[model samples]
Target: MVVTFDVSPEKEGSVLNYFYRQLTQTPAEVRGIDLGGKTAIVTGSNVGIGLECSRQLLDLGLSKLVLAVRNVSKGQAAATELSKDINLNPGTIEVWELDYASYDSICSFVERTKGLERLDIVILNAGIMATEARINPSTGHEETIQINYLSTALLAILLLPVVKSKRPLAEQPGRITITSSDTAAWAKLDERNEEPLLSSFDKPGKVDMLNRTFVSKLLGQLFLVELAKRVPSSVAVINMATPMMVYDSEINRETARSLMGKIVEVFRRRIGYTAAVGARMVVDAAVKHGEETHGQYLGLQKLKPMAPIVYSSEGDHLRSVLWRETLEEFSFAGVEDILNEVNSDRKEIL
Candidate 1:
C-alpha cells in the first residue's frame, strides 16, 4: 500500500513531515563499493542534508572532497564532525568559499578548481527557504532564486567543462547530482506570478509558506530537464527528491523553538525519517548506472516520473528562458578564465 501521513492540517505545511514519515516506513535500497581516488564538490555542505550526503560519500572512500560553504568556520566544524565516523585523510576535505547569492563567488569557486587532477562528482545541494524581506544583494536577483536556482546553474556550467575533460577511470564517468523537492508537482514554471517568488520575502507579512515551497520545487525539476541536455554520456545529472520532514540534520532543534518550529518538530518526530536514511536516495542517484534511469526524477527510493504538467509547453519555455537568463547573469565566458586563475593560486587557496 502507498502510505501517506497527515502531519499538518495545511497541504503546504505537511510536506516536510509527510515525506519523512512515508519514506521511513519504506526506505530505498543502496548499492555501491569503493569510491577511492574520486572527487566531488558539494555546496552548502556545512550542515543538514549536505553534511549527511558528504558523510556517506566519505565513508565510501573518496580520495579528495571539496566542501563548498559560505562559512569557513562551519565548514571546518562539519568536516571535523564527519571525520569521526569516516577515515578522512589529512586535508582530504578541502573547504572552499562559495556564496550562492553572488555570481562572483560562483565564478571564483569554478575558477579555483580548474586545475583539479580529476572531478568525478558535483552535488548541487544548497538551498534557502527565507521568508524575510526581499533583498538581491549585489547579484541583482531575488535571494531564493539566486541562491537556489541561479547559483546552481552557474556551478553546473562551470563544472561541465571539467567533468567533460577528465577521463573516467575504469570506465565510470563523472556524476552531477542535485537535491530537488516534491513541490515541483505544483510548480507554475511557465506562469510568472504577479509577484516573483522573491517578492514574498520583501513583505514578510505577505509571505505564504506553501507558495514558496511549491515554486522552489518546480524550479528544481525544470533545471533537471534542461541540465540533462548538456551533460555527456560520461557525465550524469541526477535529481534527488528529499524527504520534506525528515528528522535529520535538515530539521534541527532550531526549528522547534517557535510555533511553526514546534509544529514542524512534532510532525517530524511523529512521522519523519532520519537524515541518514534520506541521504541514501541522494547517494544512490549519484552512483547508480543504466541509461534507463538517467535524466529522471526519483522519490521514496525509486524512479518516480515527474508529473505530466512538468512536461507541458510552459515548462519547456521556462526551461529555455531560465537557462539563457542564468548563463547571461553569471557571464559564461568568464568560467574558463576563473578556473584557470583559481588553479594558478592553488597553494594559498587550499
Candidate 2:
C-alpha cells in the first residue's frame, strides 16, 4: 500500500532514489532491434525527458524520427543541438508542428504521419501545469485536461489506424507509451465537478478547487487503460509513472533565483531524478515486444499494478464518461470517420 501525499519533499525523495538506482545500472546496450525500418513519433521532444527519449531512441538507430512540437524554430534548434551531439543524419529527424492545445493541429499531424511505412512507437510525453488559472485553450476545456489527456487521446485514436495496420494480429505488436505522473493517484475523478479546470491562480475566492492535481493524474491513467482495452492485442499501451520529481529542461531557472525558490531548488536537487532516469520506464515499455505486457500500466521499468483507484469499477466508468466528453469537447467525430476511411482503404486493397 503506497501512501499518497500533496507535495512533500520527503515522499518525493524516496520515489526518486528508487528510480535512480534502477536507471543508473542499466547499460547502454542497444538491443538488436533496429528502428530504422520503422517509424516513431514523439510529442514535446524539444526538451525534458521527451528530448532525452528521442535522443536515446535515435542512438539505437531509428529509420525516421518525427519531433512533434508547437514551435518549429525551437524544435529545429533542439534538433540541431541533438544532431551535433550524436551526428544526427538530416534524413533521420523531421520536425512537425503539433500544438496539443489545438484539435486542428492534432488532425494535421495525424494526416501527415499516416504516410509512415509503420509506426513502431508513439510517445505522448508533452504536458503542462497551470500555476495560476486553469485555462483550457480556445477549444473550451480545462487547459491541463485538454493538452495532457484529451489531446493525447485524440492523437492516439487518430494514429490507431496506422498502428493497427502494419502489424499482424498474433505477432510482435506496436506500442503507445503515455507519460503519466505519480501525482495522478492524489484525486479520483468526480463526475459532479466536470467543469473545466481553472488555472491555479484564476480563482477569485476558490481554495479547495485550487488543488485537483491528483484527480487529473488519476483520470489520465484511467483514460490510457481504457484505450488499451479498446484496442487490445494490437497495440501495447503502457503508462510510465515516474515516482520522483524530475530535473528537466522545463524547470524555470529564473523563478528558482528567489530565496524561497532557491530553498525549494536545494531540495529538488537533493531528490529530483534526472531526465535520463525518468526516461527508462518509457524506453523499456516501448521496446518490450509481444503481447505479454499489453494493456498494462507499468511503473519505472517493471509491470506493476496501477494505483487502487485506477482499478475501481467507478473509476473505469468515469474514464468512459471522460473519454466521450473529451471527444465531444475536442470535436473528434472526424477522427472516427477518418479511421473508418483508413480501414476501408485497407480492405479495398486486400
Candidate 3:
C-alpha cells in the first residue's frame, strides 16, 4: 500500500505542542507479549530509548539480548545496572562494541552476530544529532548523515541474513526496526534533482546541522521502503518508527547548546516524554506481529501516513536513487562483500 500524507513542514509551536501531548499523555502498557527463547540486538543500547527498549525486552523474558554500544565499558555498566531489577537469568544480557562512526566497527559487529542461532529482533537505535558541521573520517560525509543514515543502512542491510535465517525458528516473523523521527516530516530534499543528495553536504554552507538531521532521517525512512520491497514478509519484516519527542535523550543536549537553544530546551524538557515512555513506540514496533507493519512508517504507536513526497512519483525515483547511491557508497567503503553475503543469503531463501 502506498501511504501518503497531507503534512506540511511542522511549525515550531506545533512541534512543541506535539511534544507536550506525548509528555503529558499516559502511554498504553505492553503486556502478555512473551519474547522467550528469542535473541535480540539493540544498537546504541547503552543509554536512552535504546537502553529502555532493551530493558523492556528483557523484562518480557527474552532469552538473549545484545547491547551494541560504542563503549564496551559503558555497555557493560549499563547491562549491570539494567539487570538489577529485571530478575533475568545469568548472562542473559551481553555487551558488544559497535561504533557507527567506523565501518570496521560495524563490520566486526556483523561478523560477531554470525555466532547467534536465533536473531529475532534488531533495533537500529544508535544515532547522533551534531550541532556543528563535521565529517566522519571513515565515510567523509556529514557526521549526522553518516551515523544516522549511511552506516545505519549498511548495518541493517548486512544483518538481513542473520535476521532472515532465524525467522523460521521464531514464533512470529523476525523484525528489524529502524528508529526514525517525526522530524522526517520536515525533510525537504530536492526530489526532482537526480544528483546524489548526500554529496551536497560536502559543499560549504549547503546544508545546516538541523536540515542535515532531517534529511538523514528522511533518507533512513526511504531506505526502509526499498528494503521492504526487496525482502518478503515470510523472511523478515522491516519498518521505520518515530520515538516522538524524547526529551530525556542526549540529543536534547546536543541540540540545545546555545543560550537561546537552552531556553527552548527548558520547555522541551517540561513537555516531552521521558526516555522510558518514548521507548514504548520502538518496543511496539519490534515485537508487534503481522505483515501490516512491513515498510510502514509508525508514529504514536500506530502505522501513520508518511509525508506526501514518500508517495509521489518523485519520491519513488528518489528512493531508487538513494538505494543505488547507498550501495555504491558501501562498495567504496570496502563493505561490498558483506552486501554480497546478504544478497546471496536472501536469494537462497527466496
Candidate 4:
C-alpha cells in the first residue's frame, strides 16, 4: 500500500499555493456538455451548492434528477422552484427523503434507487460542519463525523453496484462525485491506536469540533482511494472535489456567528467563490469523464494533487486503518452483510 511519488519541496509548496489561490479564484465557466437522457441523484439538493448543482444539471439536459434532502418539504419546494426557473419539462425532477444520521434512512434511499432504469451519476453532497461537539443518537459518533464521513461512506459504497450496473447502458462510465474540502489537509489523526477516531469524541475536550470536520473530510478522501482500487474503471469512477470556501451557505453560517467566526467570515467574503461558482466544480466533476480524474482530488474545476500527507507513508497507513475501521462501524450499524455482498460482487466484476 506504499504509493510513492518524487515530490520536491518547491513543487509541493507550489501546489499549496495553488490551493490557497482557489480561495479567491473565480471558477471557469462550464459549457458545451450535454447530459441528455442521463439520470442523476444529488444528496442535500435543497440549498447551497447542492441546489445550484441540481439546477446546472437540469439546465444541461439531464432527463431525470432526484433531489435527496432531509427535509422533504424543502426538497419539494426546491424541486418546484427549479422546475419553474429552468422551465423544466414535466416530471424531470423528483424529491426523495434522506437523513444521513439514520442508517435506516440511508438504506431506504439506496433501496429506492434500485427502481431507476439507469443511474448515471451520484453526487455525495450532503454534509455538515459543527461548531460544537455533539453525538448522533443513532450512530453514537460525533455529529459531524457521522454525517460527513461515516454516513456518506456508507451510502456511496451501497450505491456502487447500482451505478456500476448502469455502466453498460451509459454513454460514459457512471460517476460517484465526492464533495470533499481542502480543510482535510489540516487534519492530523493519531495513528497509534486501532479504535475509530470519531469514537474518541466521548472523552471530554478530546476532540476539537473544527478539527473533527477536517478529519471527516480526510476520511472521505481515504475512502475514495480504497474505493478506486476495488472497483473496475469501466464499472465506476470515483473522485473528490474541493469547493474551497463557499460563502452564505448554512455551513458557513454556523462558522460566522462567533467573534473569531466573524473574522474568518470577513476573510472568506473577501476571497471565497460564490456558492454558484463553487457548484461548478462539483458539476464538472460529475459530468466530465477521463482516466486522469479517477481517484484524484479536483479543485477549482481541475485535477490537483492532494495534500502531501496523502502520499506519504503515514498517509498510506491512515488510509488502510480508516478503511478497516469504517467497515467495522458499518457492521455495528448492521450493514456488514451489505458490505460483504458488495465486495464479493466487485471481486467478481474485477
Q: Candidate 1: which stretches are off by over 4 Å?
A: 1-24, 188-205, 251-258, 332-350
The parts of candidate 4 lying over 4 Å away from their true place are 1-20, 167-170, 190-198, 332-350
Q: Tens-digit lDDT track for model 1 on 46-79?
A: 8877887888888788888889999999999988
TM-scores for candidates 1 onward, in order: 0.80, 0.79, 0.89, 0.89
Clashing pairs in 4: none
Please state the error at residue 174 of candidate 1 in Å.
Answer: 1.1
Tell me the lDDT of candidate 4: 0.79
Per-residue lDDT, model 3, residue 333, is 49
Best by lDDT: 3
- In Å, residue 110's CA in model 1 sits off its true spot by 0.7
**Clash count, predicted structure 3:** 0
Q: What order do you get sorting by lDDT, best first?
A: 3, 4, 1, 2
Full-model lDDT for every candidate:
0.65, 0.64, 0.79, 0.79
Q: Write the per-residue lDDT of candidate 4 for residues 1-350, one digit (tens) a residue.
A: 23333443236325366456765477776788888888999999999889989888888889999999999999999988888846667778999999999999998999899999889989989998778888788877778878998889999888877886665553577888989887777776653254555466445565677877887887788778877776655666788897777776567667678899999888778877777888899989887757567787787777776765667887788788888778877775455565555457457765
Range of the 10 consecutive residues with the lowest summed lDDT in candidate 2: 195-204
Model 1: worst 10 consecutive residues (lDDT sum): 1-10
Q: Model 1 TM-score?
A: 0.80
Clashing pairs in 3: none
